[model samples]
Target: MRESSSSFPPHNNTSNAIHKFWNTIKCCSSSSTSASFLFISLFICTLFFTQWSHYIYFPHSTSTTNSLQFSNWTTLSNNNISHDYPKKDGYVLNCSSSKALTITCPPNYPPSNRNHKNFPSNQTCPDYFRWIHEDLKPWKKEGITREMVESLKEKAHFRLVIVNGTAYVKEYMKAYQTRDVFTYWGVLQVLKLYPGALPDLDLVFQCHDKPSIMKKQYRGWRAFVFGSRDPPPQFHYCGGDSTFDIVFPDWSFWGWPEVNVKPWVPLEKDLAEGNTMKNWTSREPFAFWKGNLRNGPRPKLAKCNSVNKWNAQIIDQDWIKESREGFKDSDLSKQCVHRYKIYMEGNAWSVSEKYILACDSMSLLIDPKYYDFFTRSLVPMKHYWPVNTMRLCKSINFAINWGNNNTKKAQEIGKEGSKYIFEQIKIENVYDYMFHVLNEYAKLLKYKPTIPEGAVELCSDRFACSPMGLETTYKIETMVNGPSEQGPCELPPSYEPLTLKSIHDQNAKIKEQVLAWEKENYGWSWWTWW
Candidate 1:
């Protein structure tokens, strides 16, 4: 199970962390090991003075912005607005029957239906979006019915309905920490970014880290399934081929305030700048991995935290201590000083994958069972060097040695990986993925989507920019500035059966090549170290 960030201090006071950063730099200088510290300290100091205030912790979040511009999403009142769905686990909102929540918004916000941009005729979406069709393919023969969606009510944490491009949401249960809240905020931002693209649709979205639906459950279900229905198409944060749920980008894209990690837009820009301050040749040579090693392959990774044994530096994260320290040591921008960084799963696919790849360091990606929205498109050698599961330390050790020996090749891989992330998965692509995934899912709905009786309509300004919680603070920092200057890229068509098979085969062959190289270079069972 994914661990909760509850141990963290509710508020992240990073805006006032200059003193802590001083202590961190002093400690680094005293340690006197890697010159990478020199670069990081200088880089941190520069960003601290210039970019820090824009991201300063806003205790009363609404104080930061003065403009109150908003889209045309006034809730349409109905006599039945206050009623609830009689169903056991389900409730939702219809776009037409909007009942706005009583949250405060800046009274003078501007109208949304202005300055809308058009999609460029030359642009195409990244390859990962093709899976939207694959994910909904099970219901292709028999289009998804309302009964299948209603049956999932028991497992859903919340229900979301989008009608005429406005969002209405109903909460059934609380997800771990603020997953449900931020996930909802993320969806709202998508609507704000692309005002009227998402079609009318209803979905039962669960925020849990794992997939609840299994294909075997609805193995032989007829299109007419209601009670004890087949594992219907469910939307969740993540999944693997082993499970049948649809995967979207996890909530960290907006921000993970519990960990004091900023949202992707600012964090991505900051990390990109940090990557520029130091070159590959001027970094710490050992492969680095740090996090809460409480589950999955992380604890075993701790064994490789030795210079001579694994040529890797693995640090166990103490979240409580970091939180108490005002998250000085937990800054994502400060951690990219190493030449090679490791990506390992913690019970599931880690959100750190994007941060790691963005560092322009040779990313040593270990085998993972689950994948998020973009990891599937990652080419083994081009984006990252695949680390094997067996003899874990030995594998990591060999990767570090090989990278150090082949600096240019390793650096190119790092650049390509970083380029893919920055160029392909920009904030626009993220919104596009959300747009197409929901748009395709809406195509499969056999019944007209409706606003659940008790649903609350959400707009980015009122719901996301509320100026109250930590989630809101992060949202304020990263919310869309205006309607996107361009429309979403045109998504590529689905892969043919053989084409999909070839892609998988090609990836598998690349991994096999790495394993084969290890065997050829180092004889079997060569335990020469004392």
Candidate 2:
């Protein structure tokens, strides 16, 4: 998930932008008379045109909105629109209503994975599906209010409102590396796959890497805030310690092309088939890892790269080199030719963990501190061989040796891990996860959803137009072909208090057993975790 790259240059705010335009105008004009005329004309045109601005950007918040007004980019709110904002050919624009392009669902489209047989009345969803309930738990009792949402107006990146099956986003700031853009596209894809499933609701989404709505911070400690804001519904990619930030699926699920990874739809098959290409015994007998060594405890893991000693093959990933090769080397499916693959958190909970688990390699996952949407369901011994964070070299060694001694169990573990990821987290299941999350969250909204003041209606046509023009092809490829024949696999009932505690206790017990085995082989070392 951590990739090094040069950023596309930054654009200036209103005044500086207009000043830059004036400079260009003066440079183009032959005389002052022509320059004055051109300046007037350009300024008038700027007022009329609406340009959709997006890319990786930073520090755009409520504090900056008043000062950093759009000069080249128009503020896309409901109050100012008369007709569709037009731009140059090949570009798509969002309208209050789509007069130019009306999207009709199930457009005589190709066949999809609509279950023909009558699904059982008690068909239960996977365990990970239960996380949706926990994610929305904060808003369960009181329900989400307009005030609670507006509180995050200055804090969050975008306000997403889905009304009458149409989605719209009021962007407060730009997200890192088109994370916001692709995430919105993922949500839209969900709506397409499971039509009428996601209900109308206004939810504020925090686009930054870390969660912001801390429990202590929101408990009315600040004097300016109205009253106790116990918990505000702030949806984000990953969760933090004791935070109310709802964890949805990360953007990498769609694709991480910047790092040369394809979307999950194709990548799933690629990795699954890659498993068949090389059996576990046939694969290179080493604990393989190729990624940035700078995040979390990965730098320490790099030291364990002695193939003869630790049976570890670690690569200090060169993101630049991979990008240069058109990401040919970074295709994840090709990298599964090793018996054991390593997973380490990069910055926070990484998107790579899922891909690693799906590789059909015995995943030697270093005890993870942060988790994405699906990881909670993963049982330690069943899904992965837990490696100790404190003793990286010895721990990894023990795991490889243990697996080598117990080939049958190791192979079963590998297959089970991949089966969970490949079969369970397929494209259909991914959409189902999103649908249940959004649908349950919408049920918690106390107030009727409405289009926020500055939102542009986001449909497939409007969203496909990329300013960077990097992900257009990928987006088209990842889109759901048509509506599904069946509704989502039935979501199981929420776990009882004792049942949830038992599951947590079971995971801890498994980890403890692994550590005990490590201690018996090698002396227990003090944990200096990163």
Top candidate on lDDT is 1
Cα lDDT tens digits, model 1, 1-530, are: 46553432222344456656767667544666557767776877775544322222211111223322222111111112121112312112122311222343332232354323454436788888888778878777778888878777778987898876667766665577667667877787777667766678999988876677866555555424544544677798788887789887778888776667777877888899889778889999889988888877688898888987789999988877886676778878888899999999887777888999999999999898888888888999999999988778888888888999999999999999999889888888888898888888898899999977666566554544323345545666666666676777788898899988999999999999998788666775557311
Q: What C-alpha root-mean-square deviation, in Å, does candidate 1 show against the real structure?
A: 15.7
Error of 1 at 392 (Å): 0.7
Candidate 1: residue 471 Cα off by (Å):
3.0
lDDT of 2: 0.71
Model 2 clash pairs are 77-454
> Runs in model 2 with CA error above 4 Å?
2-6, 9-122, 216-229, 465-470, 524-530
Residue 24, candidate 2: C-alpha displacement in angstroms:
21
lDDT over C-alpha atoms for residue 241 of model 1: 80
The TM-score of candidate 2 is 0.78
Sliding window of 10 residues with minimal summed lDDT for model 2: 72-81
lDDT minimum window of 10 residues, candidate 1: 72-81
